[model samples]
Target: MRSPHWKRRLRVVAEFVLLYGALLGADWLVTGGSGFVTLSPNPYGLPILVMALAYGTEAGLVAAMLSTAVWLSHGEQVAPTGDYLERLLGLSLTPLMWFVMATAIGEVTNIRTRSLRRLRRDRQAAAGDAARLDRAYQDLVDANRALQVRLAIDTASPGRVIALAAAAISAPIDQRRTALRDLLTAATRTDDFTCYRVEPDQTARVWLRGTAAGARPVVLPKAFVHQLDRAADPLSVTTAEDRPLLADIGVAAAALRGADGTIMGCLVIHRTGFATMGSHSSAELAEIATWLPQVLDLGAQPVAPAASRAGRG
Candidate 1:
């Protein structure tokens, strides 16, 4: 414990007086002025002992000194002997006794103070650690939410999936390239662009492409197509490079299936930013894919004579 300052000094003084008053009153009631000079228990010294133990050595010494002084002032009544040695012994011994008591009390106070300080420090450290863990937990939750959103967008529609596959196949032919470009653009919004496609053999493919006004379609190799093909649900590839590819190209593709569950062509579509493909988008895509075979069956018709001849040639 630190030494007591002036404020504590003043408090010690006040305590001394109150204790002295109580002792005086008790002495007066018990023995009137007759027992006042006796060396028995000085009730006034009790508060001093208590204060010394609570505040430490400095407070204890001050309380002991004050009690000694008060006892000495009442010396005449305490000692029957008018001898100087007797008076001296009484005065000196009383203070000595108070000092001993104070010292013992102060040691206990110091130990308690140290223990309390250690407990407080430990509690503070634990609190700080808890706060840090809470922040990390919140961050994880946010990341999970973002992932769910991305998955939705990636799997939203079979039309988009089919479109992406068709685009990859058509990109090499100049005349059909625009159709691929238009499909990719329509799949996602501006600023958040991604392109993905699948090969005719149902090998999933992905690429990065961007849209500009009246611009020709840009062709690039797809990344992580094998992983997508193996995944039962639509998945997002978030490697630093893959994220940019999805955002920039705005297209992705998957394999389309016929009513008999035979693999047909591929579907393709552009995606917006990371946030675009959320749970809702993925669900929509799944529903669309379920009905795709029927839609294609109804749309298919025989080619005209002129178109058939052109195709043969």
Candidate 2:
């Protein structure tokens, strides 16, 4: 596409040269030998103007020079001059005037061309910047959507905890510890914690334990049983003095209750080191505690005395 425009410009330049050459040749032939004529406007000035407009100042200057040369050659034929001043002024000044005019015209054309090119470049740069901004905005939108999805998952129903409670009740006394193990594993999927099933007799016993490397589990005191029985809702203790017995145990605690509003056992979730539970984790545990009694009731069944003793052991 660009090639054709350049070719057209080249053709215009060729035409200018051909026309100027022909006008000069015609004037030379008309002068009939002496090559001089009376001072008058050259007939080819129009062609010089046309050349300047079409192909810029250089072509126009070439055309003007040709016209001046043709006029001088004819003027000398008409009237021979021996005066050096007259001859010099006549020959030199005419071409110089034409050259100046042509140069001025060409500079104007160049200025306009440069201005247009700069404008085009500026527009292209602006468009590229706008596209880059659009891409960045889309990336931000995608990140926000992913964050929303994670929030939804974290806030979803507490069905899994309820299901675990159901399984525990149906399980034989021997298998009760195994059920507690599974529950603890699920709860500690995010952090390492120990699980203790505080029985109805006020004895605090470790049911399932999980520990991270270089960490030890702190045993809960029998005093915690009386506290668990008295608490109406899921409770958390984090102080080093109030619950000094759990001073070594870093973070939070939650209780699991039965259908008759009795404290079946307390599920103690400990967050050691930097690990801690968020509002969502606490809410999930409370929801699970609410459904525990119903789920256990559904799974209630007779237990063999030997199997019961095996479970406690």
Candidate 3:
């Protein structure tokens, strides 16, 4: 296929040929003879000016060359009355005028075309940049609104878990255990939940062993720990598979994970009201477990030392 550059060149050449052919035909009708009529100003000026204004410097120069050829041909038909140099100088003036006018007007046309193209490009670029900025601003606004909603939910609840969690996060490393204990107690609304922290060797140590006055805390079974380890979220007594495993252990339970997604602890609620044990309550407990590592020291020593009376449940 022909490139655009070659196509444009061929079109320009064809236009010049057609223009000069029309001029030749007009000259023949006017003079009826070989030579041009001795008119004061030649008729070629109008056509050259039109070409220059329309197509810029290069096209104007091509037109000028074609006009000059026609002018010289007409001069050749004139009577040989003077010396060679004198005849040449007399014929040179009209051709010179055509070239000068074509160059000046054509140069101005080229400048205007370039300026308009540059302005169009700049405007398009500015529009694209503005659209990108608007999208970024909209994303930030959406994120801020989501954070506000989360804050409202946290503050509106009766538990005040957020306040206790904040206290745990800001408390001294030595005092973090007490803050975490308080946070969990308020979050669950019961003191009958057992908290166990997992050690590096995968041994579950009692962090806070909550026990009813006369009831002994049941020891966590291997099957229950295995289920909790595999669970992605918290498990509740309502779940069919978990219902059997959690029957004697608790109403709801969850595995506490660290930042790197490693299981760091386990929480088992040995007792809670029947009305407070459901999917929503389990989700709330799971959400609290999700942020435990961020606010509490998971690696600290156990809160309770004796596993005998509670049986490490």
Top of the candidates by lDDT: 3
Q: Model 1: per-residue lDDT, tens digit, 129-200?
A: 999999999999999998777656854344565766465454654534455445444443342333333455
Clashing pairs in 3: none
The number of clashing residue pairs in each candidate reads 40, 11, 0
Across 150-187, the per-residue lDDT of candidate 3 in tens digits comes to: 66674324447777877877889788767777777777
All candidates: CA RMSD in angstroms? 11.8, 11.6, 11.7
Model 2 is weakest, by summed lDDT over 10 consecutive residues, at 304-313
lDDT of each: 0.54, 0.57, 0.71
Residue 25, model 1: lDDT of 82
Tens-place lDDT per residue, model 2, 128-244, is: 999999999999999999877765564222455445656776789788756755654554443355555555566655545654412544446666656555554444553334365
Name the candidate, 1 or 2, with the larger TM-score value: 1
Cα-based RMSD of candidate 2: 11.6
TM-score (all chains, Cα) for each model: 0.49, 0.43, 0.48
Candidate 1: residue 162 lDDT (0-100): 70
